[model samples]
Target chain A: MTSLGGDRSIGRLLASLALAVGGMGAGAVWAPSASAKPPAPAAFCQTYPDSKSCTTGFAECATCHTTAPARNAFGAQLSERLAPGTPRPLSDQAFVSALPSALKMIEGLDADEDGFSNLAEIRAGTRLASAESFPKVMACAPDQASKSGDGRWNVCGYDPNYAFRKISLDFCGRSPNRAEAEAFRKIKGEAAQKAALGEALDRCLVSKYWLGSNGVVWNLANAKIRPAFVIKSGANPGPVPLGDYDDDYNLFTWAHSGDRDVRDVLKAQYFVRRVSDDPVKLEIIPEEEVKKRGRATAQPVPADKRAGLVTTRWFAASNTMFTAIPRTTAAQAYRAYLGWDIAKMQGLLPVSDEPHDYDRKGVGAPECAVCHTTLDPLTYPFTRYNGIGGGYTYDDDRLKAYIRGDGPNVVNAPKSGIILGKPVKDLVEWADVAANSDPFAMNVVRDYWKVIVGREPEVQDEEEFSRLWRGLKDPARYNYRVERMLHDLVLTTAYGRP
Target chain B: MTRTAFIPALALVAAMFAAGCSSLPSAGSEPAQVASIDPKVKFKDGDRYLGDLARALNMPRETVCKELGRYDCFSDAFRIVLGGVEAPNLTVHTPLEEAALTAPIALDRAALHVCTSRVRMDREDPANAVLYRASASGRPDKAWMETTSNELYGVLLNRDPTKAERARLVGFYKDVATEQGKPNPDAASDWVTLSCFALASSLESIFY
Candidate 1:
C-alpha cells in the first residue's frame, strides 16, 4: 500500500503518472529511473511570500489558482515563470527561488486591466486576475469632500436619500412611508438628514414589521435551509408535513427581537411557536417539551441533547439524510454557524488511511482521506441525534444498533467529536464551541453585511468586514447584540453608498 | 382559441401596448437578470407592491385578494423559480425583464377586471367612490381631469407628475376618449383605464 501525503502530493503524483502513462504501448518504452522523483510542492505565495509578504487578506491559495493547476491570471503568470520548460513541476525550493523574480516581473502589470497594478491590487485586497473583482475606483473631484452633495463623487460616496431608501427597504421590507420620506426630505443639512436616517433605522430595526412575514432579518435567516416543511419520507411512507417546524421561524424572530442577542439563536434555552388561534402571537417554552409535545407546542429540549437550532426539528429534517445521522447535518451546521465548508477545506489537510464507513471501499482510499479524517470525526457526536425520529436521543443504543445493522463500518466511533480542530463531547458542546469561535462571529457579520450592503462581501471590502466582525464580537461595543451590529452596519461607509 | 394560439395572441397584444407607451420599453433591451435588487434602484416585490397599492388606491385588502386569486393570477405573473422549485412567497425577486413584461399585462388585466369593477361599484354607491365623484353639473372638464391626474400620481407614484408627463397623459386620455367616440357614457371608464396605465406603467410606480 502506498501513502498519499496530501492534496499537493496527490496532484503531483497524478501529474507524473499522467506523463509516465502517456507514451505507453505506442512503441515507446518507459522505465522508472533511480534519479526520477516526485516534484516538490509549489511555494504558494501564502506559504512562501517573497521579501515583501503578501498583504493582509491575500492569504488563501485560492487568491491565485481557483484551484491548483486551474490558474487564474496571477496564477498563470506565476506558473509561466516557475514551470516554463514544457510545464515541468517545480520543487518547493525551486518555486521559492523563482518567486522573487516572478513577483518583480509582474509588479507593475495589470493582468486583468482593471486599472490597478498587480502589487497595488494585492495590497488593496482586490483580485488581480478578475476584472470584476478589482477595487472600485470612484471618480471624484479633488475638492469634492466626503458626504458633499457635489454630484462629482460616484455612487460609492454617501447619498442621504439613497441610504434612507436602502435602510427602509432592507430593514423594514418596504419603501419608506410618505410621512417618513417627507420627514427625511424635510431635514435641512446632510448631517441632520443622516442623524434622522439613523434614528429611522433604529425604529425600523425594532418595529414589528422588521419581524413580520417579509422582513429582511427573517429572509436572511430563512435563506439557509429554505425548508419545504413537507417531506415525502420514502417509498410508501407518504408526505410528512412538519408544520410544527414553523416554530423555527418564530423562535428566530423572537431571538432577534428587542435587546436579545442574535447569538441566542445557538445558545437560547427555549423555543418559540405561534399560537394556533392567532398565528401572530408566540409562546416560548423550555426545550424538554419539544419531544413530548412536538415542536409546535413551544417546548424545551433537554440540556445534554440541545444545541439551539442544530437540535431543532426543522434543521434536523432539512439537513439530514433519512434514517441516519448524516454528516450533512454536521456540514450544514459548520456552514450555517462557522461560514466554512469542510469539503472546500479538504485540500488543506494531508491524506490518511483512516476508515470512513459511508465511503465505498476504494473511495476512502488514502487519496480521499483528507476530508473524511476531519468530517467523520466531526459527525461522531451527532450519532446520538436520530434523524428520522425528529428529536434528540441520548441513548446511543439505537444508533449502535443501526450502525451494526445498516450504518457505515466507522472505526472507533468516538463519543466525542472535533469542531474547527477542537474536541467537542456532544452536540451541546459543539454549539458552545461554535458560539464562541471567531468563524461564528465572522459568519454573523458576513451574513448581515451581505443583506445590508446588497452584495457579497468581496476581498476589497475585507478591511471593513474585519472591522465589523471585531466590533460585533467586542463586548465593549456591540457585545454580539445583532441589533447593534445591524445598526453599525448601516452606518458604515459602504452601506451609506449607492 | 387553442392554448398555444391564445398565448401568442396575448404576447402580441402585450408587445403592442408596451410599444404604444413610449415611456415603457420592451423587456428585450433590459440588462441580464439579477437575483437581487440594487437597493439604489429596482421595484418592490409582490407583497409590498400589493400592500402599497391597496393603501394608495384606498382599496380593501380583501377586495384586492378577492380580485387577484392567490397564486394563479398576479403572483404567477411575477413569480421566480430557483433550481426547478418555486421560491417561497414574498422571497421572489422580480428581474427587470419579468417586471417589464409581466407588470404591464398583469396591471392592465387587473385594471380591466378589478379597477373597472371598482369604478362600476363606485358609480352605484357614489359616497365611497375614491377615484371619481358625482359632479353637480355632471360634466367632465380639463380642470377636473388635471386634478384627477395629480391626485392619482400623488397617491400611486408618491410624487407630483412633471408638467410634460401630465400633458402627455392628458393627451393620452383625450386620444383614448376620442377613439371610444364622443358622448361615450364610459368616459369615466376611459379615465379609469388611463389612471391605471399612467400609475401602473410609470417607472416611479414600478420602482421605489
Candidate 2:
C-alpha cells in the first residue's frame, strides 16, 4: 500500500488508514471461554479414576487429555468468581478460589467481552449495563422555517417559497415634505391634484410598510440567490428577493444594514433631483450606452485566453463569477485581464498539480483548482458588493479576510480570486489600490460613470469619479454615496444599453 | 409619414383636451374591440389606478387601495397623467382592450368620486369627508371602519415606501367594505361592481 502524508490537505485519507491498523491489534489477542464445551467433559473427568489412564492421580493424568468433565466444571465455577461486580450478589470469592486451577480457568471466560480485558473496560467508559443497551440520544428541532409570520413587518414574515424577485415601490401615503404638501394644499381648483395627492399618499404607506413582507419567503425559495456570503457571518444583512422583472422596482428596505450604500447610489440628498421630476423626459438611448464610452480602454487579453480575466473573486455564485455592475468598458476589460492574472497567481497558467499558496479566504485557488485547471476570462463586471456595508468598501482587513485563502464567513467571502499585488481589505481599499497601481480602476470608474449618466466623463466627471474612489479609500464614502452614484449612473447613456 | 405622425399627436392632444372637459368616452358605447394600446398608457399604474378605482367605488382611494403595485414603465407613465376616475360601467358596457375599457362611464365616474372623496377624508382631514357629505348611510359602524382604517394605516405607514405600489393592491376589496357600510339604496345598487373592482386591483387579492 502506498503511504500517505500528514499534510492538512491530505489528512482525511491518512486518518482512515490508521484506524484500520487499530482494528487488527484487538482481533489477534482474544481467546475463547471454557463454558463453551459440552457436559460430556464431566463424564470423562469422573471416569478418569476407573480408567487405566486414571491409575495416576487425575490432575497428573489429565495433562495429556483434551476432555476433562470435572476440570471443566471447576473452570466454570472459577470463572463465575472473576465476573465483574454488579449491583446484585454473586457466589463468595473464597468459594470460587477453592476450585482447582482457578486462575487459568477464570481467565478463559471474558467479561465485558470487549476486545480488551475486563480491566480495560473499567478504565475506558465502555463498560455499561450492556453493549446493546444504547445511551440516550437527543432529538433535534425541525428545520428552521424561513417564512415564520410572527414578524412586525409583513416582509419579515417567513415564506420558504417566495424567492427574491419582482421588487416594487410606490410613494403612496407619504405626501411630499411640508413645503410640498402645503403648496399642493393651496391649489384652489385642485380636486384632481388633491385626489392625486391622496393616491400618492396611499401608495407611499403601502410601499414603505408592506412591500417586502414576503422577502423571507422569496429568499428561501431561491436559496442560490440568498446572499450566501452575508448569511455565513451571523449578521442580519437584511433580505434580497431573487426574480427577474416581475415587479416594477427592486424594493430594498431601510431596515437594511447596507442602507447607506444604497442611498448613496440613489443620490437621495437635496442636491440631487428626484427621479420623477420629468416623467416624459425619461428616454433610453441604447447605442450611447456602451461601457466606458469615452473612458480609457482596459488592456485586452486574447479571447481564447481571456477566460480567466476576472479580478474581483469576492463573490461568485453558481460557478459563474461577476460584479454587481460592470457599466464601463474599462471595468469590463480589467475584469477580464485580472481574472487571468488570478488564474496565473493560482498556478493555473502552467497547469501544474501544485496548489496556489493563496491566503485562507480565497475561493478559486484550492477550492476551485480541482475543476478548472486553466484560466478563464471574466464574462461580467463587478458592480455589486455582497459584503456587510453597501457594495464594495475596499477595506484591507475585510478584503484580506475574504480572499486570503480560507473562505471568510459566508457573508464576506468572495467567490472569485483577489487581484495579485493589490491592497484590498474591502471594496473601497480595492478602488484606492487600483487607482494607484492597477490603471484599470480608473478606467472602470470612468466608463461606469459615463454609462450610468448617459454622458461622457469630462475632466470634472473623471476627477469626481477618481476622487470618489480615492476619498472612499478611507472608507467614509463607501455607504454614503450610493444614492448619488445610482442617480448619476442611471443618468448615463451606458445605463440604457442592453 | 410626418402627416400621419402629426395626426396621432393631434389626436392625443385633442383627447387630452376632451378628457379635461369631462367630454367623457361614451361608456360601453364604443365597441369592445381589444385594441392593444401602449402598455404605458397614462394613469394605469399603481396609485393612479388605485386612486381611480377607489374614486369609482365611492371609497377613500388612500384608505382603500393604499398600496400601489409595482409600477412598470407603462404604469409609471399612466400614473403621471391620470386625471380622475369615472364609473364607466354605468354607461359603456363592453369588454374592450383591458377591463377598464369595458366598464360603463357613469358607474366608473361614481366610483371615482367616492374613492377620491373618501381618500381625501381619510388622510387625517375629517373636514374633507364632512364637506363631501360622504357619510355612509345607516351610520356605517364608524368605529369599526375607523379601527380598520387605523390598523391599515399603521401597516401602511411603517412599511417600506418602495413597496407601496405593490402593497397598495391590498385595498382591492375596499368597495366591498364601503358598500357594506353605505345605507343609501341608490349607492348600494352599484356597490357590488365597485367592490369587485377594488378586490380585483388589490395586491392581497391578486398576487398575495
Instruction: Indicate which candidate wins on lDDT.
Output: 1
Per-model TM-score (chain A alone): 0.76, 0.21
Q: Model 1, A1-498: lDDT tens per residue?
A: 111111111111222222222222111222221122112122334443431113221244454666543678887776666646634555545656676677677878888787777776655545567786554433343343332343322353556776787787666656666777777777889678867887878877765556664355555566554545344221222256442445566677766666677676777667776554222355676545555674433223465566677776666666653544467888777766766665664212221233355423343544444456556666777776655454434455535545554545433465576655555787778788778765677778777775567455553354576688778788998788788777767766667765
**Clashing pairs in model 1?**
A286-A299, A286-A300, A287-A300, A287-A301, A288-A300, A288-A301
Scoring each candidate complex against the real one, what DockQ results? 0.15, 0.01
Chain B TM (all candidates): 0.63, 0.20
Encode model 2's per-residue lDDT on A1-498: one tens digit a residue. Answer: 111111011111111111122223223221211222212222223433332212111212122112322333323434455444533233344323333343334434334243443222212212111232111111112221122122211122211111100111212212133244345445554345434434443333234223232222111112112234222211232133111111111212221112233221111111111133112111222322322222111111121211111221122221223322221322233332221122222111112321232333232454454312222211111323222222322222333433333343322323232222222343333333333332233333433343233233432133344454343323454433333333333222222111
Write model 2 residue lDDT over B4-77, tens digit each, in one string: 33234223333432342242222223222221111111122334345433443345444543223333212232
Model 1 error, position A381 (Å): 2.6
Q: Residue A2 in model 1: shift from native, Å?
A: 55
Per-residue lDDT, model 1, residue B147, is: 71
Cα error, residue B96 of model 2, in Å, equals 26
